[model samples]
Target: MEEQRALRPPWALVRGAGDGSGWPWRSTLLLTVFVQVGSHFAAHGQEGGRAGLDAFARVLLVLACGQLLWRLRRPVPVVFGTAGVTALYLGAGYPYGPVFLAVAVACFSAVVAGHRRAAWAAVGLLWAVHLLVAHWLYRWLPPSGDSAASWGQEAVIAAWVAAIVALAELARVRREQWERERAERAEAARRRADEERLRIARELHDVLAHSISVIHVQAGVGLALLDSDPEQARTALTTIKSASKEALGEVRQVLDTLRTPGDAPRAPAPGLDRLPELVEQAASAGLTVHLEGEAPRLPPGADLAAFRIVQEALTNVVRHSGSRHARVRLDPGDRTSLRLCIDDDGPATGADAGGGGNGLAGMRERAAALGGTIEAGPRPDGGFRVLAVLPLRGEEEVDR
Candidate 1:
């Protein structure tokens, strides 16, 4: 069968037989030929003692091999069918040859298809019947002069069946393991995609929220003062233009990362180096921000996280607080961490600006990603404050 399979055209061999079921038509046909031809030779050795290859024995052989055609699909039925047909052939005292190959192939298919009990039952039934025929029923079976077979031969047959089942079980286990690994890898990829989407969402929210708040305030200021003060209104218009343009550039930068992921950023990510820009944008929004303490140096991730936390906090104040005065205090703590505080002296405007928004959530996500913490709430002294503490080290180093 193997040789005949190798002789076929490579494409035909790969495509296999009928309906793309991978049915081994060529192999089964070759096996039938081998069994018949092999039985002819085996008959010569058992001449005059065992029954020669006759019409009935040939029918049995063909029946056994034909059942194998359905082995890959209906393995349970095929195994039983082949086992019964092979038992009939043996009981007729036909010459032993490759006729058993059909049963072995069927058993293997059944076992590997996860029908172990069916395969075992078929094998056991075949063995039990063979035992009854070779010992107790030999006097009434074919080849009249034959004696009962030795127990030693039955032991050999039992071992051969054990080997076939064992090999098939091993193959089944390996296939299951490969399938599980592939599923786990697919699940991991989906998780990473979800995380990337969330990170992008947070980035867009931070950029748009801060810039739009500045524009909203400046637009309101320019309208109120337009008739009374042309110069201040014009200044407010200029601030709006600057804030909108910077927002577009940063937004474009964030989008570029999505288009060409894993590539280096075209512009640097926003960091504490951009803190002055945040303060300036806030001032343009009619919120006077007082800065305190020199900024601490930090790894890029922590720096970006710090900046976004401050940005979102200020945006929240602009939209929700009635206070015109805000304070930003930086604390470089212990050479290992950097602390940030954004405070607005309030009576809040009674606006739930970020209650339905991602602003505060995004801020917390950023700080947590850096092994840091964020605290934001109404202060005891009538104000709102957002406090963040981020590790000064790289995220990978912190993970270790």
Candidate 2:
């Protein structure tokens, strides 16, 4: 289920209401009008000998209620100040009616802003003051003829305070849970982005590395036969042109996938079905590529990885092994695995073979990512060989 944030007052903004700029001036104005009405009611509620707040005391009451404008941003301080001023108004023997509303609101704001400890402390202090005032009214002031009525008023006040604290605490817990859920979602997105980047890098390497290697060899062949054998040189030139054009087209396709909308049609990913074209390209590069055994149907990921592995191995043969002849063997091992091996005769002039480049490392990573393995090195029989084995079962596990 999707987690939802706690509901808050219209004036409340930002977690803990710490952003001063989001304070609601209009809402404060409305609250001020309400408190003013409450103050007037308190003034008119004066009993027999009890007196209402004088001008200075009435001003203090208005100021106490106005302080709620900052309660969300500064809950603890607002609660303390409101409570202190309300206590003074009551202690001055002024008539009591709605003056305690300001203190109650401040305490609720503190709890909603995640200041539970301070809110509870304010509640305790306010309760103590209420007790003291009740005792004073009972002992010093003449009773209003009904002692039960006085007790009932005190009970009602206590109930209101408890309700405010309970509701505010519930809101605070929900807000905190929502924040944690949002953070987790963001982290998951970051991880998926990183994985996508790695996948694109691997695809680009596979597409360009083999194509560039073929073009390199054909270019060399064209240069050598340019003067001596014009016809052969022309053929080599054609091969280079075709190889480069195909590489450019494939690279553009890969890039276009990034910009394409989800519903747009896209070309299928390269797989073992394209191995024949790869072999023909290698042969045009002056490498005699002999193939044996057809590839069986495989999972899309495994098919692509297998094709890239063979392409990289042959490219290495043309560029590093210095061999004119190479052999590719495919073994469809049972229903769960496929094996591939590519080997080339030793260098034409007995030169030391160059070490594996990024092509080899990329091939290894592709194999490993598919729960497969690749081994490439000089064979004991004076040739370079690459062997790869890919598992077909559980492709979904590898893809994720």
Best candidate per TM-score, number?
1
Per-residue error (Å), model 2, residue 57: 7.0
In model 2, which range of ten residues has the least summed lDDT? 1-10
Model 2 residue 364 CA deviation (Å) reads 4.0
For all predicted structures, in order, the TM-scores are 0.85, 0.76
Computed on alpha carbons, the lDDT of every model, listed in order, comes to 0.84, 0.75
Q: State, as a TM-score between 0 and 1, how close model 1 is to the true structure.
A: 0.85
lDDT of 1 by residue, 1-400 (tens): 7675553433233222433456778777877889888888989988987898889988999999887777767889999999999999999998777888888888877876789999899999999999999999989888988998889988988898898778767766765776688689899999999989989999889888888888888888999999999999999999999999999999999999989999999989988888888888898888888889888878887888888888889888899999989898999879788889999999788665334477888988888877889998999999899999888887898768
Candidate 1 segments whose C-alpha is farther than 4 A from its true place: 1-50, 54-59, 352-355, 397-400
Root-mean-square deviation of candidate 1: 5.1
Q: For every model in order, what is the number of clashing pairs?
A: 0, 0
